[model samples]
Target: MKILITGSTGQLSQALQTALAGEGKVLALGHKVMDLTKPMQIRQQVRLLRPDLIINAAAYTAVDPAQGDRDQAYAVNAIGPEVLAEEAAALGVPLIHYSTDYVFDGRKPEPYHEEDEPRPLSIYGASKLAGEQAIQAVGGQHLILRTSWVYSLHGRNFLLTMQRLLQERDTLSVVDDEVGAPTWAGTIAAVTADMVRKWRTGTGGPSGLYHLTATGETSWYGFACSIAQNLERQGLLRARLEPILSADYPTAAERPLNSRLNCARLQRDWGMVLPDWEAALHQCLGNANAHQANHSMQATQSL
Candidate 1:
């Protein structure tokens, strides 16, 4: 099957590319090749590629900046998927889109199920919710995967940010109120590939919105503490970690206090299971260390 993946350079898309390498002909399109903000460009590219499947991983992810950039955010996160769904419907192809757990207001005390009513509190969440709605309105073959706190070894994510900050600073403060799973991009990509393969083989269940995230939950402060502990074990710098409330670190957008998503439906239907946040983090950091060691060896050999 020929697959077209948007946001090629992004963390999730990069993982998808690697995961889907043996699936079929994969055409990776970055912003330079296909800008999500431009509907006409999206239409033209989809027409040109005529791919069997289109996985939209591109999104306007600047939550704080989105408060002042609603238009751009909607253009990419909302209108882009709408246009993609329309094109997919026209071509009779399935479209796989990614959404966010931010769609919830975080008022719920328990984990959010797939059927939970979304009450977005911030502009970014609203835009992403709009995207999900727009795709459903198009009435096409689509699978909307709502994930949370996605990070990877690559990309500008909280993990890398903490790693850098821990090395550069003596003390670090993280919000302890906001709770969610720190999902690894590679895990999402691998599961996506499995779902796609099952679909192709006519074994995958019906398509709809499903929550895909790590097994457990943690606050930003807890996540940072875990990262710091691992880094210190690896002979990295040790920094004093401080836990603070969300209000202590103000931002343009209001984040949800609870971002936990229930993955029961995904597991029941697709038979997909992801590692816990802590396990995934350990593997990710281990891979990073291996990569660095290989690079250093290559450099020394060249000298």
Candidate 2:
């Protein structure tokens, strides 16, 4: 299977590349090669590549910046996917897209299911929801995976941010009110590859939305603390951290208080199971440490 991964440089795309290394012929396209802001670029790229499967990992994820720059967000996150879906439908190729937990208002006391009605609170969420709608309306084979609190070893994510704060400051405060899963890109990518393999041999692709996230849940503050604990175990951090509320840490975009996603339906359909968040974090941090060690070794060799 010739698989095309968009947002080539993103954490998830990178992980997908690594996970699907021996699975198939993988082609990665980042913003530079295939700009989502320009729909024509996407259409042309798909025409040129003629890939069997396209995984749209690219999205405008700047939550706060999206408040003021809604046009750019809509262009990339909303209209861009719609263009890709149209192109994919034209070519009869399957599209695998990613959405967010932010599509919900986070008011429910339980984890959000795939059937839950989306009530996006921010422009970013609204744009992503629009993209999801477009993919459904395109009448093509597509797998829409909605995840939350994405983090990886080598990305600008909540885990890395907390690690930096711990290194730079003596104390840190994180929002405790918000709750979600700290999903690893590696897991999501692996599951995606599995799905691709199955789709290749199976009768047909599951053409609808699914929630793929780590098992268990945590607040932003809980997530930060877990990162600190893991780093401390690795002898990488030594700072005091405290938990606060969302009201204390204000942002232009309103975040959902409950971002947890139920993956039962996904498990039943895909036969994929997600590991616990802390285990995922530990593995990711170990990867980060290993990468740093390799880089340091290369620097010493050069010296």
TM-scores for all candidates: the values are 0.98, 0.95
**Which residues of candidate 1, in runs, are more than 4 Å off?**
none
Which numbered prediction scores highest in lDDT against the true structure?
1
Q: How much lDDT does each candidate structure score?
A: 0.94, 0.90
List, residue by residue over 1-303, the lDDT tens digit for candidate 1: 889999989999999999999999999999888999888999999999999999999999999999999999999999999999999999999999999999999999999998999999999999999999999999889999999999998889999999999988889999999999999998899899999999999999788999999888899999999889888877887679999999999998999999999999999998997899999988888899899889999999999
The global Cα lDDT (0 to 1) of model 2 is 0.90
Tens-digit per-residue lDDT, 1-303, candidate 2: 788899988999999999888877899998988999898889899999999988999889999999999999999998989999998999999999999999999999999999999999999999999999988998788989999999887668988888888988888988999999999999899888888878888943467899999999888888898888877877878679988989988999999999999999888877887899889888887887788889999999999
Native-to-model Cα distance after best TM-score fit, residue 127 in candidate 1, in Å: 0.3
